[model samples]
Target chain A: MPREITAFSNPLVKRVQALREKRHRREEGLFLAEGLRILTEARETGRVPRFLFFAAASAAHPLVRALVHAVEAAGGEAVETTPAILSKLSGKDNPQAVVGVFDQFETRLDQLDRGAASIFLVAERLRDPGNLGTILRTGDAVGAGGLILVGDCVDPFSVEAVRASMGALFTVPIVRTGWEEFLAWLRGGPGQLVGLSLQTEHDYRAVAYAAPTFLLTGNEAQGLPDDYEAACDLLVKLPMLGKADSLNAAVATAVMAYEVLARHR
Target chain B: MPREITAFSNPLVKRVQALREKRHRREEGLFLAEGLRILTEARETGRVPRFLFFAAASAAHPLVRALVHAVEAAGGEAVETTPAILSKLSGKDNPQAVVGVFDQFETRLDQLDRGAASIFLVAERLRDPGNLGTILRTGDAVGAGGLILVGDCVDPFSVEAVRASMGALFTVPIVRTGWEEFLAWLRGGPGQLVGLSLQTEHDYRAVAYAAPTFLLTGNEAQGLPDDYEAACDLLVKLPMLGKADSLNAAVATAVMAYEVLARHR
Candidate 1:
């Protein structure tokens, strides 16, 4: 039997709602992920949420039951709540039937096995949570090892980013560090640092990407700094035949990632 | 001298603010675009706004002055307004210094010159305005002739879509029509209908793409319908190396567009 909470004023409901904010998530060391599919993905990835909240209507769902079982087995609480409370937790008029609170995965550059995958993605000062999530999905699609964030970036654990990732957040490892530290780690590893730059005349397709290629993209607006570009082992530019000077940050990263994937294949 | 509008209650301000809504934009046959760079792009592309609003503080900016000159030369109204009024109009706390009202471009499949560019993009039932705008930007970056929207789709003129396009909406010709109509029009021309499908065993890169390749993608959640996939001249699937079964609709389109571009180059 699961715990029941119907009131919006319930303490657990308030705690779960707070996970929507970055500061709250960081303080609690827990993040919210909604929908059965995402929670199933988390389970498949050997992650059990600390708390599982499901609407009473979804109690009979086999997937939901499986999730409830997993939560119980893991000594986590399973709560049966009203749709109104679920809506309050998700901040959406039409909320998912299920929402889960999971501990944040702390990833480090030193822990990453560069030899595990042929490609990796690095973003510098990425500000958009949606873009960060889209990049994570692209990383998953291309089978890249993980995504690395250098400098200030929007929280990957934000609800907006987690939603945008479409569950890639669980599948892809994310690392947050400074530029100097990231460069130092790359220097220590056997990886080709390729910077996507506008200054270079070298076409993105014209180059032969070496193994363990690390594709680096810059901020949505400012792009990579001069010294950062200078440190790259190679610089490439995507063709922009139209009047628009550049593609969206996430779109550019996807294009480059696919190009690298093709070469590796 | 430009007209001065410091009152938020002004009818003109209300009218401009109404453009943010899809129904109002359709009824008025107008749309809003913000930022000096985007407005300049519109001007360069030979499309002048019917009304240009600039903050009093930004009136002296060289770009703003140039825009004012262009609007005045074209018999368009240039209004000097307060930042608060601009914010009210744009619905952004930190609104751009300038915003413009322009007539929506009426585009049709018959008007598109498919031979003008070797690549084109088609999206089916794209629900997200942001994804629609990003696709337009991708179309511009790859020099696609245009983007064709099939079935019920979000308004390209929505402020969210327009902003996300980053002025690509001005450059890329967008056609909205039913799927059957689009197929009939596409079949009448010398082009290849290549769809991004999960059903296909053909790797996206393995195919020898013909000239005038029309890259088609499905909706964000459901993907392409069976009949739509069957109708394609060539069906291609992007590699999903990780657990994610699909990429973000816009990101997938960008990846495919770049591949077609590479082959054409």
Candidate 2:
């Protein structure tokens, strides 16, 4: 039987709600993942949430019951809550039926196996959480090794990014490090650095991409710094045949990822 | 000389601010496009704003001055305003220095010149304004003819969509119509409708795309309805090598657009 918590003032509710902020998430060493589908994805990936909050309305749902079992089996708590509390935890007007608080993954560059996949996505100073999440989803679709965040990028674990990733965050490995540190790691392995740049004459499709290719994208507003572009093994440009000079950062990454995937296949 | 207005309660200020809402935009037949770069892109595309609002600080900027001149030349008013008013109009705490209120394009399927471009994008029931905007940007990047909305979709003139479009909203022609109407229009012309669907065994890259290819994508969640998929001349699916079942609507469209572009080239 799950604990019934009807009060919004419940301590556990406050703790989970506090995870909405980055500082609180960091301090708590956990993050929130909302929706039954996302939570199910997490469970399938061998990640059991520390706390599972479900509205009484969805407690009978087979997926919800399965998730409750998984949480209980993992020695985690399954709390039966109200929709008001669910909405409060999710910070949405209409919250999903379920919300899960899972321990944050402490991913590092050293843990990544570069030879495991052909393509790796590297973002430099990617500020938008939505873009970061979208890139993660694209990374998953292309069977990339992982997403490496170089320079000051948005927190991959942010709720906005986590939501945008469509559960790709649970499946894809993410590495956060500075540019020099990331470059050193790449240099230690067999990888080709391909920067998507406007300055390059080579078309993205024209390039012969090597295995273990790292597709690097720059900040949304500022393209890669001049030095960053210079360091790339190959610099390629997507054709901008219309008045708009650039594609959205995440869209460009997806297009490049698919191209790289096609070439390798 | 540009007229000066500092009061947020000013009638013109309220009118422009109201454009942030869809109902008000439809009522006025005008929409807001913020930022100097976007406004410049609009001007370059031969679409001048009916009213240009600029901060006092940016009034002397070369691009802003050029915009002012263009607005005056086009018999439009350039109002010098406060940053607070700019923020209020844009609904951003730190709004861009410039904002433009422009007449929304009245695009129709009949107005499209199918022979003008080799690629066209069609989206059905796309509810997200950001995804809609990103699709426009991708369409522009691939040199597609335009984006045609099938069925009930988010307003293309929404400010969020315009911002996400990165000024591609001005360059790309947008048509709003229902599915039956769009199919009839396409059948009346020389075109191939290729839809992105998971049900297809065909790979997106494996297909030979004809000139005037119409790439159709479904809603963010529901995807292409069964009947809609049946209507496509060809159905192609992007490979999902990971656990995530699908890509973000806009990202998937971009990947598909580029693949079609590559084949035609």
Candidate 3:
């Protein structure tokens, strides 16, 4: 039987709750993964969490039992907690059955086997966590190399972004680098820099995204900085037919990613 | 000078806030529109809001003044309120410069000129307000005739849905109906119904969407019901290359909508 830790005031409970903040997540090099599916994926990916907590309501669930056993076998702590504790950690009235506390797993652009992969989505200074997350999901759908976050993009580990990713964050390798470094790498890197912007002449579909392609997107508000356009081997735009000034950043990225990768698939 | 309704407790303000709820919106046949941009689009589309409220911070903004004049000229009320009041109405601490209260504008599928539209998206029992809103925005981006909500879908007029639409609610016509009525209308209608599901053997892109094309999608969780698949003139599925069980409903719709419409545009 897993040990019971029912108190909502438990110090461990507080620590899990604190992981919701970027600062705490950074300081601890840890983040929380909610729901059985995400935790299951985490386990299957060999990224088993250090801590596993489950609500009393889910104590008897077969999958919960299996997950708890999996955690314990992997030298992780699996503790049964009160629903109140789980709800507090999740910020939801009706929380999921299980949660996992995992170490932040990331790789740098320089660390990757660059030549092995061709397609990539480069996002610059994306502010919205949801958009970034959805883009991560889209990236996975197209089997892109990885997502390279340039400049000051929102933390992919942020709760909103992770939740929005719908488990793709676990699959997608996120590379964080500064503008100058990323730009320099792209220039020397083995791929085309296809910048998407409203100021471009070519229709997004009209462009040939022949693999070994790096599809670049920018911030939600101001879009790609003016000089950044110079770095692009090609620039393309999604048509704005109606009164809408822009497509949601995630939607635009998904459309572009699919156009680039889907046909070939 | 526009009237200064300084009191947050005012009955008018109370009613406007209540419009956030589906029951209240249904009862009053009214809904709220936030931000200067959406209101401006509403005005340009000739769908003038009945009530306009501006934060005093925007008193000097030229566009705000023009919008206020436009509202009042159309026999609508335009009032100035404090930032605190605007915040209360918007549920955002830093609310936009202006908000508008508009009458519900909707129609039935039968009322639409079916022959006029080549591309259409019919969503069945979509539960997410944000997904519904994004689909509406995508529908407008492709200039689809309208969105046909089959069965009990989320209210597109809800505050969250409208907010997510990013002003497309003004430009896109929304039609709500039950399954039977929608099916009957589709049978008599000119467009071909293309159902999207995981069960289908056909790849979504393989089939040419001969217009008038009705791209039908379903709920986030369960997807389109089995019987519904029988109704589709053609059934296709987006490639599921990764571990994700499904793509976000809105993303799927956008991918399909753009494929069917963008090439034509």
Candidate 1 structure quality by residue, lDDT tens digits, B46-121: 9889999999999889999999999999999999999998898788999999999999996899999988999999
Model 1 Cα lDDT, one tens digit per residue, A101-164: 9999968999989999999999999999999999999999899898999999999989989989
Better of 1 and 2 by DockQ: 1
Kindly report the docking quality category of candidate 3: medium
- Candidate 1 regions exceeding 4 Å error are none
Candidate order by decreasing TM-score: 1, 2, 3
Correct interface contacts retained, every candidate = 0.93, 0.94, 0.49
Clashes of 1: 0
Error of 2 at B81 (Å): 1.8
Cα lDDT over the full model 1: 0.93
Candidate 1 similarity to native, TM-score: 0.98
Docking class of 2: high
The CA lDDT of each predicted structure is 0.93, 0.93, 0.85
Ranking by DockQ: 1, 2, 3
lDDT of 2 by residue, A185-260 (tens): 8999799999999997999988799999999999999989999998999999999899878899999999999999
All predictions: root-mean-square deviation over Cα? Answer: 1.3, 1.3, 1.7
lDDT of 2 at B195: 90
